[model samples]
Target: MSGDVRLEARGAAEETFVDTVHDLLDVLFERGSVGDDDQMLFRLAVSEVATNIVEHAQSREPIEIDFALTCDAEQLCAVFTDNADPALIDLENVGMPDADAESGRGLAIALAALDELTRRTEDGNTWILRRRRQPAA
Candidate 1:
């Protein structure tokens, strides 16, 4: 579980977000490490991040997503990357805006769903998401 899958897209708009997530999920499913719930959560989290890039990342720059699934006797890890500017997002302040708000909940949900979430901007914003896969019975 120390392999990586690298995907790149130029001018990927919101219309292609679902396809990206599906592609990632298909890879994970093919590896036989992702279960039903894990698949759902992965799709949800990836979509949220991808949508954020499409909506707020300013330029329609090329997006690079690197999914690294690593497993030992403990857990699984997924890392995503995009070339969009990261300064626009305030990760520390992710919260529900209000009960009637239509947006602003995706990031919070993603935070809660993933066991570990980390974001950093070097050349571009990179998000690392980790979750513990269930042990074989």
Candidate 2:
């Protein structure tokens, strides 16, 4: 019950990006031995990340992102690699935005839901999200 699910979305709109992630998550949950709580939380984190990437990406050309999800007996992980310009994000400063804020809560929510979330921008932008699996009741 452990393998990988991958998808590539190019120039996708925010809605499309979320839909693509939903499709990938459907496949992952179906194939992996993930508990219901784990599946729900992971889905939320993944959707937030996908929406953030689609909404904030800056480039003259269409955006290109390679997304991968992997699961094993003990954990689940996701990686996102994108061709857009590197994003300057301060993860340490991420926090829930004000109540009136229309945006800015995605990273905070994602970070709170997952065991680990990291971003790298050396060659290109890469985001890694991981969570430890919970035992089924």
Best by TM-score: 2
* Clashing residue pairs, backbone N/CA/C < 3 A, model 2: none
Candidate 1 lDDT tens digits, 1-137: 34443433334445566476567557665665556776677567766766665666654556554444443435556666667666466767887778999888878887877787788988877777776666554
Q: What do the candidate models score in CA lDDT, each in turn?
A: 0.63, 0.83
lDDT of 2 by residue, 27-137 (tens): 888888688999989999988998888888777767778788888888888888887788989998999999999989999999999999999986668899999999888
Q: lDDT score of model 2?
A: 0.83
Model 2 misplacement above 4 A: 2-14
- State the lDDT at 33 in candidate 2: 63
Error of 2 at 51 (Å): 0.3
Candidate 1 deviant stretches above 4 angstroms: 1-14, 60-73
Q: What's the TM for model 2?
A: 0.89
